[model samples]
Target: MGKALDNVYKHQSLAYKYFLYLISVALIVFFFPKGGKFKYEFQKGKPWQYENLYAPIDFSIKKSQEEIAQEQLSIRNSKTDYYTFDGSIVTTVKNDVQKGLEQWFATNTFTARQQRDALKIGMDVIDNIYSLGVFENHPGSNSIIVVRNNEAVPVAPSDFLDLESAKRRVSAELSHSAIENRIGLESVIQTSLRINLFYDEALTESALEQELSRISYTRGEVSQGRLIIAKGEVVEAENFKILNSLKEEYESELWRGNNYYYIILGYTILVALVLIMLFLFLKRYRNEIFKNNNKVTFIFFNILLMVLATTLMVKNNESYVYGVPLCILPLVLKNFFDARLGLFVHVLTVLILGFVVPNSFEYIFLQTIAGIVTILTASELYKRANLFISVGQITLIYIIGYFAFHAIHEGNLENIEWILFGVFVLNGLLTLFAQPLIYMFEKLFGLISDVSLLELSDTNSKLLKELSDKAPGTFHHSLQVANLAEAAANEIGANAMLVRVGALYHDVGKMEKPTFFTENQVTNVNPHDDLPPRESAKIIIDHVIQGIEIARRNNLPDRIIDFIRTHHGTTLVYYFYKKQQEMEAEVDENDFRYPGPIPFSKETAILMMSDAVEAASKSLKNPTFLVIDEFVEKIVKGQMQANQFLNANITLKEIEMVKKVLKQKLTNIYHLRVEYPE
Candidate 1:
């Protein structure tokens, strides 16, 4: 039944996941409203309100003709019942007819070309008709005047100003001007004239002054009968709809800016829940490694890491920022799995969030950098007081992400500064906040979290301090193994620090029977010295199982427990197995072996290799470079022949590298060479 259920769960189609994702996106788009506008209103020397207000005119214009037209309209609309119109007449006149008897000067001019050039300027001036609008009687009252028939032809309204006097004044002004010689009218007829009218304030005030002096003929009294048109064109029926809607749309957009904020809020909640669900799923399979109460703590801390990662991915626009989230999952997983699985998780999360966030290649780069840095920095974070390392990791993230953002956006230093401030704040605050948030989430979801690592490494952690006091020899051995394994792993490009940390805790189970283990004894007297060979072998082989049980009893991480289980591959206990075989010459080799599932992971493989090499190197008689090299080769080769290296993903090339590094390190540790006398 369990197998059937597993098959059913595993075979669920990819199409289902994609369909759910599509539905999620569609819901976000549909629910997030995007039509809102806002306008700024100024009143009483203060911005009274930012409201939904509409303006009829757009005063900003780029075209010269449009600018000129607007300005002309402003002037024309400054008054009412009076219009100033400009019309042009195109005309031709006989050349040289008016320039008569200058007998002494003109007849002696040069060639036709010279004559044409000189004559051109005169004809150009004479060929144009010009009009002007003027305030005739008052500031607000304007009249149009055209110079025609050697007179100012008054185009002012007949009832307003005294035209005779106005015309005389205009004629007198024009007669002595430089343009007077160029004034010649062939034929004058008005074309189209567009007129704008508005109530002139000055005119109204003047009329009040001249209330009694107002010469009213056919038109009614100025104060009583005149229309009060606005200072600008009023918003009328024809164009009102377009302007009103435009204003409303802008208003809606501005006021509804919160829509995006809500989207982010929704995104946050959704992501957190997703991470929590993932944690829970992993927890259900927790029994696969070992049972523990700290599953809630483990899940909580990982979720916190994921949340920090998601926060890093948040951007101003909805462009993809996949790397932050992608990088995060692998880091959390690496704490629980092998490095290869960690990398796979990282890549998978990147691809998944890339689809979810709809980001570009830049998202991948930032996430990848963050993932790599986090993996490197936090690999040893299982140690004491290393939470600050996450902050340092975020700083690296800031630098890398800053350059990546700049590269993607084609930005420079100034953009870099803002990006640094933004991404740094995001990283730091999220990282800091992740701790508490994970705690809270664990409580809420009833989940396990890795945040316990911080507490587990505390100076006062009962188990660690107890191990140090009660089994100092075992404790010292653990430290040595940690160092060796770390070096070896680093040389092979695996997560060296992580391997070392796991090694430190791998033998914690030995604390249960400190006297039984050789390292925990002060003297070199073996406890197994008085026991039968099979009985000694049984006790020796059972330490791994005991260590695994102790790790679970104390709620240690699965990763640490894995090292305890697999660090000693199923090889023969040479001392015990050899003695038993000689005692009973027909003894089966298989019966003398360890309860054997060998190292199946790189970390465990590293631990096993390092543990054997470290212990064996100490027993070398008269240790020398040649002697150490010989021993290193023999041990590594022996493990290989026994197929102990089979399951650990250690490549032959990597094994060679590991051997070289181990030999070098062991030589230094043992002081294999004598120094020359100074």
Candidate 2:
């Protein structure tokens, strides 16, 4: 049992123990309504080869979305409503009648009773006419006939003359009365009244919408045991409509029962299969990532986060499905892993999402194409321009995919949903924000990306600046090592940016005791000569420990600090040990060796090789091309002979390439032209 466990986990840590727990959570999240998968498949405008089908129950026929929209349009075109009444307008007319009558009677020397009679006649005139409410006249017509609660009332240009007719009627009816009173009544009626009606927009719209809600969506119905489509019959629009209607009603049938737990378990198994495959792939080919649960968690978490977003969008509405930024997943994952892994994970996620979305084929196809474009074009992610170009290409792919499928389904572009193109555009704009999001993931997941590595490579950074100030010689040495390692990494197709950053900060431990090292001493005085051999070696080896402390103090990523820990490895400090042995009868060799786990990756291994070669070349007696080339070869060969790079996944071919790069780079650094003319 112990042997089997050892093979599974080479070094058991607390992080590895939680692997099962995290996978459990991932399965729970992936669980959806998936226990019962439809057994049959059919496509519109295609021949059905399956056996004849019968309705399982009395499923009601549902209206297609287009049919529902047309019905609603018809109802809206015929709907009409009116405000019915306006009390404020009646008050205004009454006030106007009073003011006009009082002014007219003030000019006459009429008795008090005459004024009273005059006011009564004017008020009665306005009240009588305005009782019939006015309505908006239709354009290019004489007047409008408004239907108020099944009562038709005609309001015309003649209605404006009602007060005029009222004036003549009152004067004749009151002819027997005094002339002064009749004249006052006539003036008041003309001036006091005008149209006192307006269209009520808010309430009128409410009433019309209330009426619109009554339009029934069902134009027709399909009875139970109805023949939908027979075997080998082509599914045209008529049969397609009936099939869709049946599918809607069948899925929504609650009386048949649904086992929620069984459904969850089924989906969990499906997601587990895909994720376990990912784990096995990583554990076999990339165990470093597999053992580190944080990296695995980061990848799985990204997939889950994307799936959750998609599921939520579908739950809200299927039209929201296109608005989801599915392309953004591959674009982000490619930043940390290889393009193949990114594409694989994206395909799996889109496949799972297919069961949730309405138009599964188009949803998967457009997103899969977008993922491919993202992987192919999103190179040099540190350069903002590359990311921008990749986003534009991804959006263009989505638009073309949408257009092609739209034309295929509708048989023409006439019914194309132009808004879906806008959705793709929005998705591209969201993808451009990935630069900032990279930083967030790095912090949250404790992982680094190429974009962060670029920022770390700057020499003016805090730790690099301290190294330059305290130990200028060590600082210059780090720069040459960075350049050499970068070039070597490029030749081997390793992570060049990561190697360069690692090389720059590998010797930060030297900053703690700078004067003890030969390069930083820069004087006749040797600090190491004053101390015992064991003490001198101890100080030399302590740099790796001190560098790690300082790096962690400044919150450096664990990935970068890996270089400091492994650059020296467990090799002996031969110069000090040999000196101690010649002077003393006996010496303990372990005290003169640096404690290390050795280089464990291509980047760290390259750093180790570059550091040893660059530091040793400074001791050249008289520099020559042949001498420098031999010097580069000897140092790398010695490290290899000691099996220092045994754990790092590097090949002899890659090491030879590194040797060639170092030799050419060192030769150029000290290249001298012939002095024959002088």
Best by TM-score: 2
The superposed Cα distance between candidate 2 and the true structure at residue 455, in angstroms, equals 1.9
Residue 313, model 1: Cα distance from true site in angstroms: 14
lDDT of each: 0.55, 0.77
The positional error of residue 509 in candidate 2, measured at the CA in angstroms, is 1.2
State the lDDT of candidate 2 residue by residue for 1-678, as single tens digits: 989888667655544635654665465455443334444566765688799988766755667788778877876665443434455766886887788767776776878987786677666655666666433332133433444555655555454333345455546655665546465576566565554444556755675688768766665777777777899998888888778767766555522455555555566677667667777777787788777777777777787778877877776776867777877778778898778878988888888777667778778888888888888999988998898899899989988887787676667778777788888888889888788887899889888899889989999999999999999999999999999999999999999999999999999989988999888887899987788888998998899999999999989899999999999888889898998998897898889888897999999999999999888888887878778878888898899888899999999999999999988888888874445774
Off by over 4 Å in 2: 1-49, 82-187, 192-210, 231-234, 254-256, 584-586, 622-626, 672-678
- In model 1, state the lDDT of residue 673: 66
Model 1 worst lDDT window (10 residues): 185-194
